[model samples]
Target: MNSLYWGEGGRFGPFDEQEDGWPNAGQVMRYFREKSNLSAETFALLYSKELEKAGKQNKRGQVTATWILNMEKQNLIPLDMERRRIIARLLHIPPVLLGLATLEAVTIQSRKKKPMGTLQKVTIDLAKHQKSIRDALHIHRTSSAKNLMQDVERDIWTLKDIEAQVRGDLLYQIQELLLSNFLLATRIMKDQRNYPAAYRSANEAVRVARQTQDNDLIATALYTRGCIKAEWARRGTVFNGMFQLDTGKMKSAAKDFQGVLQLEQETSIHPQLAGFTRLQLSRALAMLKLGPRDAKVAQALTMVDDAADAIDADPVEDFYIRALITGTLTGLHAGGYHLGRSETLNAAGLPGQALAELNQVRQLRQGKTYSGDETRYQAWFDLLMSETYMNLGDYPEATARAKNALVTFHQIHSPRNMASIKDIQSRLALSSYGTSIDVKELNDMLQEWYKPE
Candidate 1:
């Protein structure tokens, strides 16, 4: 089977096609409609009724089967804003797909209907406000700040109102704002350990981006969704005692990442974003827990290395990307030793050597400023240190590090890490004091925290 046609019926199939000579808007619309089992005349009738609801008088005067046919043939352009919107709604397609020029004309007409500042000015203000919220999230590692949450919520409401008044080219900008808000919401909810709400926000971001027909935004939305799914999977393991791989969620995330990579290849835009997508793809693969000797694990390691190289070569200098790639490389290298070499080292009683590998992870983070989810990396480092101390027969140090790890995990609301820390602490207590301690109480506490309020 051709790799190109692999998983053709999957959720990401729409994004798998080669880059060159992509179909135009009309071709895309026609293909989707036909695939939906709708006849041209049937679609035309529904579209005509939609136009009528938008105050387009006389279906025969505005549109007909012939007009629909011409539109599908790319011979007719729906330059009218009302008609464009109605057609988009009826066909369940983005108005931007109609054409950039058509979308720009619609944007200009929509701006004329606004009572306030110019479109450019309003767009700039919204972008700045969104950026401020994003910066706050990065600096604080949360959206829990009262004033900031209030501002973000207020901005969301304002965006909804603005969305109702804008379409076409400006619709992309509005969708970008919606994506930002929802992405932020997703992160905030995730930080709060509210997986369901995080997933909801991510889904909304994808929906909004789809309406803009912007592949970059759509890819970003997919990435956000994938991250949320992966987090949920991680939480499930931590809270539910399901140690087996969450294959379903990991597969879904891989599909999303693959879709992003396909889109990037097609568009040739945002090379750094593509690198990030590849990094994420590597993560999803790693989470499968394929044995270190497995071919898939080797492939995933290669992907991690290749992604880091690509990011290093990106002309656009992004500190966040640099930090992320560095941290990822460090983690992957540590994980390789933990999964493969550590077993042999432990068997040989050369635990100190294993400790050295884990210590390298900490050294890599020195003087680095991580832009996103810094707590996660910190908690991971603490966990690694705790394990290393345990291996070295320093039970007291191991217990202390485990307790410290628990604090960091608690701050991040990471149930899985907390559970792992509790287990480590229990082991250290038993080994050093000859007192067997049950972690059931700690596990129960985590269960309560996992419960939705």
Candidate 2:
């Protein structure tokens, strides 16, 4: 390792003294200087070499030991952003350690591979470095699920401290990053079946979104909150004991979905947002309408139909959109085909038909899914199929499908889904099938998993 590349390029490596988040520029200066074990004068020699190598002619000609001294004491400096970049490169640290986007973000922006909406030149310049920082740092929930959570969680908390120093559009950008982190954490908790924790994380996202007045962001946060509630009502063992399908948490989820729609009606939302919101609403409604004759089921089907007609009507051709394939599952067509139709079929006492439809959907998903949504999509589908088989009194198939879903959840370190399916595991334990070989192995695996490390 180079002398400059200390702390794993930031607060995460050795020299892990107690810092709140990634270091500010002054702190970076101090950490790297001390780690080099060089006098400020000698450090200035390296700083000068870096500036000269970059062909950067510093105002006041060159940096001196006193300049380094002033910076270490947190005094503001001129040409700060550029000089910081030069110093970061000198120290062989990640640009992020200086609260800047990674070098990759700059390269991506230079190529214009991604657009940043309609920002004028000044705003573009202001946002250019920040354009993809959040995405670069954020881990997909199913990817790196077992590890990285603690590091990312700490980064999310550290962002608020970063937020206080900026103002105007840049501040909004930081807030958006904060909101995104909160949403990502919300997803993690929800996947873990920590509904209360998920709800709290989601509400923080909502607060950040509303503060920014970005309507689409606000809608996403609200919709995510609805998802947490709906998932909890469906899978939370404690909540299942307290609330039936028609009312309680399911209805609460319905209300939040309705609120998103209401917001959409008041604004011009993205077509995809409308599609996702309606499809999720359909799930809540289908769950609420347990009886065959219930009108809500029909209403739920209507929403699904509308989403299919609109969101899935066009064959996707956008380059970026076309390129993002998540394993073997892709767009709204699968969500509508599986969650919408299969869920309604199950709720309407058509478990056989639902199982058939689900199998068909699985076939559709095999070896052909969008890269972004594949794991989550597959995991949820497996869990739903398990529930449907349980309804049909196929305990073996139910246990098998449940185990399959558990495997994905386990891969992602999701205890919530594990717990949700644990109930089915327990019910299976009460039957003659409990003595079956596969069931016994699953029981043992789950026991080992739940044990404290």
Candidate 3:
């Protein structure tokens, strides 16, 4: 396969810390500064001035220009993790990238034609890199974090931290990390169009939560698992870029939600958590009504109403729970809209409601009050809003919302979202009217329904 296609230029070489020296965060700072066309001393001056503005003196109550330079040279500045993260953000580089002592290089090479029965070589190289990363992760898992080399040390440390805290006071941290990983894996699988993997990861998250002995963790995991199950059922575990709906997946999702509800009944979990989980379950079941069964749809609607009642009984200041509810509600709205149930639209205000929910999400982000999973959950809401507006024949609105979603999507590195937005833009471009679907747009979407695998 490697012979079938060309590879990129670059050699895979070791990143030597002692030889190359620790990464000068300041050098990176300088790189971003140059990229932004700012003076080298601008940031240093800004920091100094900001210190003065805060009624504090510089290191010697003097100019910080040389001090900044010294810090850059020694790679000893950015005294705090948050500060380092901020600098990384300002520089438009990943925090992880900045710590890299040496970059792994890959160079593309031209393909040479061979005899018949040969596969492409380019694909092989790409596979090799992916396998390498996965293999590294596996190896790191078996070793102690302190014993591991720097390259794998960070991941090893985090994994060990998660493991060490899973049964202790840091159980919350474990649940949070597992939840984030589960969500990340879910998005990845969805992007690769691999539903089975997404479902498996989601289930694994639930299992981890159970081990944590945290009711909040357990319930939240179940809620998220239900969502993934619903998504799989709605879209089918198989995909070919078509929107062919699958009822079996929805039923499976519904079953998962039921499992959540059953657990809620048995455990003394937080009321808010239980309420939110039941709400999610209702949303999953609601999706099942997309079939011709009117009775089932009615029952699903009642379940949703019942969940809503329960939510009203729960506390409102719980930001995490609110984030979860918003997500589940958005899903319900989407499922209802697709099922051609007028009542679904009436019961839910379509994407318009989702847009309002995103405002709350924005508040959550600004407040810096949410954990990583909640942040991603809010981001998903933003994506939902963009998609909803797009579906309602509002191209400009859709495009703007899509752009916001793209920013968050890139941060999270979800390929599935990137692809979905690309398809949406293409549809918008081919439409005669900028807003609203004409016959052509409808035809294009329908074509997607029958796209080949």
Give the top-scoring candidate (TM-score). Answer: 2
* Clash statistics: count for each candidate: 0, 11, 17
TM-score of 1: 0.55
The best-first sequence of candidates by TM-score reads 2, 1, 3
Highest lDDT among the candidates is held by which one?
Answer: 2
Candidates, ranked, lDDT: 2, 1, 3
Could you give the C-alpha RMSD of every candidate to the true structure, in order shown? Answer: 15.0, 15.5, 19.4
lDDT of each: 0.55, 0.62, 0.48
Q: Candidates' TM-scores? A: 0.55, 0.61, 0.43
Q: Which stretches of model 3 miss by more than 4 angstroms?
A: 1-195, 207-218, 234-242, 291-293, 305-382, 426-453
TM-score of 3: 0.43
Which has the better lDDT: candidate 1, or candidate 3?
1
lDDT of 1: 0.55
- lDDT tens string, model 2, 1-453? 211112211112222111433334565567666766878898788888887887776668777898888877763433467777877676665565565642221211132332322111111221332333334323443343425457557767666764654444445756766776676667667655677888998888889888988777778778878878888787664432122333588888988889888987998555555677787888788777757778987888788667664445434544222211100013455544456567766766778878887777655643333344446556878888887988898889988888888788777666766775676677677767878987887787778664321
Q: What is the lDDT of residue 223 in candidate 1?
A: 76
